[model samples]
Target: AQSVTQLDSQVPVFEEAPVELRCNYSSSVSVYLFWYVQYPNQGLQLLLKYLSGSTLVKGINGFEAEFNKSQTSFHLRKPSVHISDTAEYFCAVRAFYNTDKLIFGTGTRLQVFP
Candidate 1:
């Protein structure tokens, strides 16, 4: 079984400031990691993913994450966040064979204040 853990349930940051969302995972076998965002009244959408290749993976909306295997972490970060970036972020992991099902974290609500 695979599981994800979001270190912070809520993150408050001022507009145009750099922000980082912490994510950790637990899995007996290798798994694919992902970051998804959900806007108000909207379903989740993929933000980024770590399938293979480079350890540093870039995502949509100016987001990027680094996959640290030893640490079992895939923390999301942005150079400077805008107010529109406010949304609920989830960290997920699934086996390479299983792409449809995702083990998600509790989710972190990013509040970007003006």
Candidate 2:
């Protein structure tokens, strides 16, 4: 079985500060990593993903993540953040070929302060 673990449950940052949300996972099969952001009262939006080919993957809103197979980690980083970035971030994973089923971590709440 595979599982995801987000290193942080809540992250508070000043506007324009850099942030990194840590995610680690363990699996027996090849997997795809994902980061999704959920705005207040809204649904989960795909932020970035690490499927294949590239070790580094970029996503929307200047967010990027690196895939480390040996370390078994995919951490999300942003050079700068805005108040509007405040939202719940989730780290997820799925079997390499399975797209419909996703195993999500206990989300990290990003609270950007002005």
Candidate 3:
């Protein structure tokens, strides 16, 4: 089965601070990379994806990530994060041919303290 690893479980930062969430994956073949953000009790929303072409991908809410083939990693980054950006971020991966489900990492919680 495909697997993903989230380096950090929690990250605390002040409002308007910069944040980064590291993610790595292990797959036998090519895969799709995705970042999902979950705010409080709400469901997850697609932040960004690296499907094909270009190593860098940009997502909603002023967030972005870079796909590194050599490292098998997709790291999320935001230059400046607001209080609203505080949420649980998850790194996920899907096999190129498998449409059944997505493999997700443990997750990283970004707490923006005011």
Q: Alpha-carbon error at 44 in model 2, in Å? A: 0.6
TM-score-superior candidate, 1 or 2 = 1
Clashes of each: 0, 0, 0
Pairs of residues at least 3 apart in sequence or in different chains that clash in candidate 1: none
lDDT of candidate 1 at residue 112, scale 0 to 100 = 99
lDDT of 3 by residue, 12-99 (tens): 9998778889999999999999999999999999999999998999889889999999999999999998989989999999999999
lDDT of 1 at 23: 100
TM-score for each of the candidates: 0.97, 0.96, 0.96
Question: Under the 3 Å rule for N, CA and C atoms, how many clashes does model 1 have?
Answer: 0
- Candidate 2's error at 12, in angstroms? 0.7
How do the residues 1-114 of candidate 1 rate in per-residue lDDT, one tens digit apiece?
Answer: 888999999999999999999999999988999999999999999999999999999999999999999999999999999999999999999988875889999999999999
Full candidate order by TM-score, most accurate first: 1, 3, 2
The lowest-lDDT stretch of 10 consecutive residues in candidate 1 is: 95-104
Q: lDDT score, residue 15, model 2?
A: 95
> After TM-score superposition, what is the CA distance of residue 91 in candidate 2 from its true location, in Å?
0.6
Top candidate when judged by lDDT against the true structure:
1
